[model samples]
Target: MQRVKAVICYDGTHFSGWQVQPGKRTVQQEMERALTRIHKGEHTPVVSSGRTDSSVHALGQVIHFDTTLAVPEDRWPKALNQLLAPDVQVMETSFVDSSFHARFDAVEKTYRYRVHLTKERDIFRRHYVYFYPYPVRVEDMKQAAPYLTGTHDFSSFCSSRTDVTDMVRTVHEITVEEDGDELHFTFRGSGFLYNMVRIMAGTLLEVGKGLRRPEDMPAVVEAKNRESAGNTAPGHALYLVEVRYE
Candidate 1:
């Protein structure tokens, strides 16, 4: 058996997230179905680097699968794209050592959140950006971002629905940039808890809008309580930008 690594990009507008559910349409389900067809009815499982929530898009999601087929690496993307839905595409593929596991081998990940700060909504970007019309003090958000960076218990920003007890994660960076009426928040970290980025974005947004003080961020992180954080932003605005591996 050979392990194949593929870089995937998807719109995530209509699917039920990356993982396969009993009856829901999902990115993994579509990928596995295509692989199954490629192997002539044999089931093949594709493992992703991480699970993204419903409506959360991806520019560089990575996955790996073991296959017995002899398809060439250069043709993998073309072959898979032909079978996948229009919204999901396999951008690149290559053979790797059998020991390379997409999830286990990942060393870092970057996620981007887009926020639209205009009074009128742009229908074209409605599916990709969070609409926050309230005036934001961008500098204040930047100041608060540093407090959330580095290693800490992120339980306050994680979703209560998650069962994972370990809330500690290292955030290498959190950058907020403004371009016209849009604010781009990029987060790079070792890993993230369920809904962690969204909650952090919401908390930072509160600070930006002057509803919360930037100094409160350190206290929020220290509290380790979900109630200490701000609201959880919607998932549609988040994008899994890239995953890194050593």
Candidate 2:
């Protein structure tokens, strides 16, 4: 069998999520379905770097699977793209070492949350960017973001329903960048808990609005309570930018 690795980009607007669920459309299910048809009735399983919530998009999500077919690596993507739904596209494909794993081997991940600041939301970009027409101090959000970097127990930022007992993760960096009428919150980390990035966006947004002190961000991290953090931002504006493996 050949171990194949591929990078896929998907518009998650209509997906239930990445994983397969009964009676639901999902990225994983579609990927596996395409592979099943290629294998002529045999079941095939695909594993991903991580999961993205419904309405969340991806640009460089990684996945792997073992296949018996000896199809040329260059042709794999072309074969799959013909079968994948329009919203999910296989961008790159290649063979990898048999021991490589998409999830456990990933050493870093980058996520971005986009916010469009305008008096009126753009109907064309409505599903891609979060629209906020209110006044916000970008400097305030920048000042408060530093406290969220480095290794810490991120219990306050993740969802309370997360099954992860170890909430500790290293956030390598957090940058808030402005481009014209848009604000981008880019987060690079070792990994993230469920809803962690969205919560961080929400908390920093609160800081921008003068609802939270910039210097008090450390205390919020120390609190380690979900209630102590800000609200969870919506998923539609979040994108899985990249996943890295070493």
Candidate 3:
């Protein structure tokens, strides 16, 4: 048997999520189905770098799996794509050491949230962009971002549904960028809790709207309560940009 690693991208609009669930369609299920077919019906399990909620897209999500098949590493993507749906594609593949893990070995991840600065929604991007027509000061949002950087117990920024008790994580950077009629919020961190990025996006949006001051961020982090954060931004606007390993 050999281990293989692959980077994949998917449009999560139709997927229940990345994980397998009874009576639900998921990215894992689809991938494993393709692999199982190639393995002549033997089950092949795949592990991902992390899970993305329903409607959340991925540009460079990573996965690893062990298989008995002797397919060439360079040909794995072509083989997998032929059997998988168009919405999910295997972008690249490589042979990995037996000890390398997709999730545990990941050192950092980057997620980007796209906000369309328009009151009207466009048909082309309705499923990929968050439309917010409200007035927001980009400068205020920039000022609030620094408060969320660095290592901290991100309990307030995490979702109440998150099962992890240790909420402390290092955020290497949080950048808010504006391009034309869209605002792109990029978050790079060692790791992120469930809903952490979304909540932070919402909170920063509030800062831009003048509902909260930039300085209020310090107290919000100190609160360590889920209620202290703002609304959870819609998952459709979030994308798993990349996962880094060392």
Per-residue CA lDDT of model 1 for 50-75, tens digit only, reads 99999999999999999898899888
- In candidate 1 the C-alpha lDDT for residue 213 amounts to 95
User: What digit string (tens of lDDT, one per residue) describes model 3 on residues 1-246?
Assistant: 899999999999999889999999999999999999999999999999999998899999999999988899999999999999999999999999999999999999999999999888877999999999898999999999999999999999998886798999999999999988899999999999999999999999999899999999999999999899899999999999999999
Off by over 4 Å in 3: none
Instruction: Score candidate 2 by TM-score against the native.
Output: 0.98
Per residue, candidate 2 scores C-alpha lDDT tens digits across 1-246 of 999999999998999889899999999999999999999989999999988998899999999999999899989999999988899999999899999999999999999999888889899988899888889999999999989999999999989776789999999999999999999999999999999999999998888888999999999999999899998888999999999988
By summed lDDT, the worst window of 10 consecutive residues in model 2 runs over 155-164
Candidate 3 at 154: error in angstroms?
A: 0.4
- TM-score list, all predictions: 0.98, 0.98, 0.99
Candidate 2 positional error at 199, Å: 0.4
Clashing pairs in 3: none
Error of 2 at 184 (Å): 0.2
Give per-model CA RMSD.
0.7, 0.8, 0.7
Better of 1 and 2 by lDDT: 1
